[model samples]
Target chain A: MVTVTLNGLSVDLRDRAVLHGISATLRPGELTGIIGPNGAGKSTLVRALLGLIPATRGAVEIDGHDIARMTPKALARLVSYLPQGQALHWPLSVERLVALGRLPGLGPMSRLGADDLAAVHAAMKRADVLHLAGRTATELSGGERARVMLARALAVGAPGLVADEPLAALDPGHQIDVMELLAAEANSGALVVTVLHDLTMAARYCKRLLLVDRGMLVAQGSPQEVLTSDRLRAVYGVTGRIEFGGGSAMVVPLERV
Target chain B: MPEIPVLRARNRALIPLLLLGIALVAIASLMLGAVPIPTARLLDAALGHGDPVVRAILLELRLPRTLVALMVGGMLGLAGAALQGYLRNPLAEPSVLGASNSAALGAVAAIYFGIGDYSPAVLPVLSILAALASLALLFVLAGRAEGPLALILAGIAVSTLAGAGISLALNLSPNPFAAMEIMAWLLGSIENRAMDHVWIALPCIVGGAALLLWDGRALDALSLGEDGARSLGVDLARTRARLLLGVAIGVGGAVAVSGSVGFVGLIVPHLVRPLTDRSPSAVLLPSFLGGAALLTGADILVRLIPTAGELKLGVVTAFLGVPVFLVHLLKERRLW
Candidate 1:
């Protein structure tokens, strides 16, 4: 089983502290949603977890190995990351774009074989962008590009997947569809952590929620515990109304506190 | 699924054609110089069986010039592709960004100081060192935030600084003859070069190109951008460092031999990029071949043009390259 642990992790950017004394644990088969408002260090936390940034204090450990000590190649085999925006410079075909995720698995001189191609195909199917395989990634619409980027991340088939705002440019329907895809990925045994802005969707699909505000982890637990009206009012300055149906939780934010 | 393999196969098939093109152009360049050598005699001279005069002309003159042309062209093209791929900017090239000029300045400094008269090897060594130093300074000044405008601006600044330095050296030279020597070298040419020049440049070019070609896979990963590529286990800093040193050595060697031949690097890659799979790694080798062909062809064109004192190769490239650059700028006008 894969487990990612953050021991009092903190980050300093340009001498300004962005994340401070944040501790969390992500386990296999758990889809964790990180929710925070603007300037709340959500992206920074995700970047640190991916080892894209150095933690100023403590450490981020994956399966008991300090992430900083692992080689990039070794770390890549365990963690797959998808950044927020879809920034494609070249007009590579959609299939080629997804195949980039297979780089870690392939050797320097080794070409893709049946297993790698199968992973690419499976990722495309999972992200529902198989029809756009021949299309140029740069020409795709916002929602389509989001799906294609997701396909790229999924092609890694790593033990842990982290995405920053995967649903940003997507419409409501695609948003729900992507959320379902992420949930399915978690169920398949990867520890999925996503930075999300949609509180209702996070409550619905995420098995655990981590709330951050002003660089500190304010609360962490199930949706019913972390999405409490008191914490929502205090941290987000909005009153949250929670309801349960069919064993799923939905949250509606009332007027600002 | 069918289209992906088909496209890849087509791209792979283009490599041999590019090699063939380079061979044809090299032959044409060797044959079409000041005194045309007949085909049979050219072959005999190539095999060291001709009259001493003909063999001297063939081996001592034409072959070196042609080889230098091919290598410089290939170097320019390869450097352009590597820089463009690494920076993710289509406008990145040694010449356009003033890297070649910086190298030229270094070589000219060697001549002005009379170190070049001591040994031919000193020129390229100094030039390559200058190219690396200038580029390092550029990265330090610009930092990692490579917006299109920021990169172009930084290139302009470096180019201007190198140009000013060149002017200062010329003005300070004690002898008018030394100044003239610097000026001729600055104009750039593949004419009158011997086997010695080829020997001096060959090693640096090969080493630099090997370094660049080795980073091909990493360059492909970089098409995903810094964060994405890094996340995929590609070390961005190391890849960029390797690329800069590679370009510096290759461009520096080209400048020392040919004296600032610009735009082959910039134009050839743009010309051949459409034929590839839109991956940086795929673009590199083809760009190298296309460059060799273009420079060899351009060298032949200048010879056939019947110009007064022959048009400088650098001038021919600038006249052709600048317009294409302008067209690209026009298309990317929104960057302004």
Candidate 2:
């Protein structure tokens, strides 16, 4: 597992500043959620960390080294990241699309080796998609596609993962299943940062919640400590009830204030 | 969601049909020609055989022409397949970059100035150089953002201007026979070509095809879109340069010898699509084989069609391809 540290991060997207001077240290083995309403720069912040978008005023260090100079394949192997929109290519079988995750480890002229196959099967199993391996990604339902996307990420088997809105279209059952998958990864000591719109899933699954508004972190703490009703009203402009029930605290978004 | 069994079965069935079509074309190519060479004599000639006249006719003329047709067709087919896969645009072909027109202009320039007759060897050299240079210029003009259609328009513009220049050059030529000569070359008949012409184009075509084969994985990534390919570590600039160079060498050399034959590249790939399991790699080699077969068959048809005069190979391919092109155009319009 590796830590990700963003220092004085500022991002300009096509001449507009999307992220402004945001800084955070993400700990290892933590299922951290970057929770915010739309246009809060959740996606921008993550994109910045991946070094996909150049940070205008700052830099990011992965485990104390600059990410600026790493080769693309090496960076991919070390840190797997999923952006907001999933790429839809050929309507390939789930097994084949997931196998694309093994590309960094394999050379151009080489076929998928035994280790690659095993890891793919394991990753698909981890994402609860073992049964759907033979199915085409395009043919799957939205939630099923989300899980398959998660499985593609899992197939990367990186030390850390940063996924944006991974649960946006998932149904409640798959949402819980996917959250459990993330929690399991963190429990196994991989740093997993997920950007989520569903506060309830974020509250129940992630150990740490980084709440942001207007490109700045408003709160960073445990779900119960950070997801207060007052915080929700101030940051998201929504009314919400944060109550401890059934052994876990749930942040239920009541209504827009 | 459960359209699985049907699609799988269709993919499988298409492969056999494509194979059968290719085989039938190949057999017909060997049998139907000017001499009416029987199968036994054909086999004997192929085996380097008994009658000196039959052996000479088969080995010297028929064999080389058939082989040239196959290779040229293969080159066009594979080139077209690679271009379409790279751009993800169905209309993409090597000619979209003006390689054919540039080659024609180079050959015409050589003939008009009496330079080709001065050194017979200089014609192909001039054609290859001009074609390669035009592709390089196109690479610069289009950059990465221009897709297949953009390339086509740029090529059309270049070709039209070059064609007008050819007309003027031919008109001003002192040799009265120059106009008829240029017209015949422009009409694109693969007649009186021998093993020497085949040898001239073989190395360039094969080398260019090797580069195209290197582009397979990258083309697969490009199907995801440019940004997607970049994310996967594809160096866009290098791939573009390689792609253009391959097109220039293979296509320019082809037009150098055959004089602007159209649609082998376009027709062969589309025809072979059924055999490739809908995979890019499957399309690549099969298109080559299928293209070779189609052109050879067309060449055989040119030989056998019993006209008062000989037929043009280009005319036959165009006749075969026009209906297919129109069908694709109509089908594509309805698809969208």
Candidate 3:
């Protein structure tokens, strides 16, 4: 299992501070959702955590190893990332696209071995894109593409998975399917961190939620603790009603505060 | 799924077939020059039993020309595929990206200043330096700009500036002979190129090609775009550095010898892409082989076309490349 530790993380983009000093310990075997409004530095936080972007004034440690000291391939073998709204530049087949996730594990001259193929097949089966393997990724429907991209991420077979807005542009049904898959992934004993926009979905699926507002972590706890009406009004600038029922929380924003 | 294996088998067969084609074309190139040698005589020459005149012609003249064509063409195609893959833009090629022109300008400067008269190495060295400068300029101008249009615009600007430099050198030449030499080189050809040219260019081209080929996996990852690729642990900075240096060296060596041959790089990859899986990495080796065949074939055509003066190899490539490029632009305007 992996534990991600953010130590006084701050990110400055072009001299403007986007993420202020924040620290949190994210444990594995849980689905943790980062929920925030637009321009809330949610994406930046994830990028910095994955070492895609350098932290301006802090350090990120994965299981006590400083991320800055780890090579990209080393970090990638530990955590797989799926960024939002990816554009396919080539008409690569779904199988080929998914196989790219194994890049971190393979050497420069090595071909995909049997184990790699098995991982690809397993990931495709898990993401329910096994049937679409022969088809071109560019021609797939929005929902199909989303799952294919997810399968690509899953093919990494890393201990930690960080996905940014995987539900964006997906239909409600597809959204539910994706959430179920992520939850299953967490249940299987992997760290699953997702940046989500749907509060109700986040509350229902994620075991823990980190509420970010203007680059600061306002609350970090169970959905009921973080989704309080006062915090919603102050951070989201909306008056929302949240009801806990059937072992889950349902959140609905009535109107702008 | 059955079709997948069949398709893969077909793709797998392409490289061997291309090699065979290059061999055939090289022989045809050897046999059918200004003074055509019959196959029997060509074979005899190969076995060292032919007439000494025929042997000299085969070994001295056509062999160097054919080797130069293959090397220059292969470098161009490889560099083109690498650039297109790195930028994720199909329009990126050595000439289109201003690499060839800048290298050509450097060679012209070398010749104009009489440094080339001192040694054959001076030309390619200066040209490689200029190509590196152009690539650096290209990154500074279009590196962060969004969309394919920005890169194309930056390339055009670089090409125009390099073209102006070449023109200024030509316009202020110390003698008419220097000006004429500069003009002929600008048109681009492999005619009368000796083993010296091949030796001068081969090392740089091979080194550059190695650098380009080394990053095939990284190029494949780049299909996901910068952020996604980075997330997958592809080092963008290192990949970009390799691409720039590779293209610069390859284009520099090519233009130093062949004098700014254009469109071979652009055309070969397009032709080879459909036969492969269409991954950026998959397109590379085939493009190189196809490019070698194309230039050798074009050089053969240069001999057979019955012109009062032999047509320059660069001019023929432009003639062959423009229509294909236009068709691509018309059919895939959205790609730009």
lDDT of 2 by residue, B148-194 (tens): 45666666776676677778878887777988788778877677778
User: What is the C-alpha lDDT profile of model 1 across A54-103, one tens digit per residue?
Assistant: 89998999988999998888888899999988788887888888988998
Cα error, residue A225 of model 1, in Å, equals: 1.2
lDDT tens digits, residue span A1-257, model 3: 89999999999999999999889998888899999899999999999999988899989999999999999999999999998896778888888899889999887656777788788888989999988988888889999999999999999999999999999999999999999999999999999999999999998999999999999988999888888889889988999889988766789999997
Best by lDDT: 3
Write the residue-wise lDDT of candidate 2 on A94-213 in tens digits.
Answer: 776676667667654455667777788888878878788767677789888888877777887788888888877677887887788888898899989999999888888888988878
What stretches of model 2 exceed 4 Å from their correct place? A13-17, A36-41, A54-57, A130-135, A210-221, A224-257, B1-32, B38-56, B111-114, B144-189, B308-310, B322-336
lDDT string for model 1 (B254-282, tens) is 88789988778887777787787777887
Stretches of candidate 3 off by over 4 Å are B1-10, B118-121, B133-158, B174-177, B326-336
Give the TM-score of each candidate: 0.93, 0.81, 0.94
User: What is the per-residue lDDT of model 3 for residues B1-336, given as tens digits with 9 covering 90 to 100?
Assistant: 122232234366898999999999999999997799999999999998969999999999999999999999999988889888877878778777788889999999998999998987788789888988998998999887544567678888999999999999999999999999898888889998789889988988998898898888888888987777777788877787677678878888888889978889988888788777878988888888898999999889888898887689989999988898778667755433
| Count of clashes, each model | 0, 0, 0
lDDT of each: 0.84, 0.75, 0.87
Q: What DockQ would you assign to candidate 1?
A: 0.52
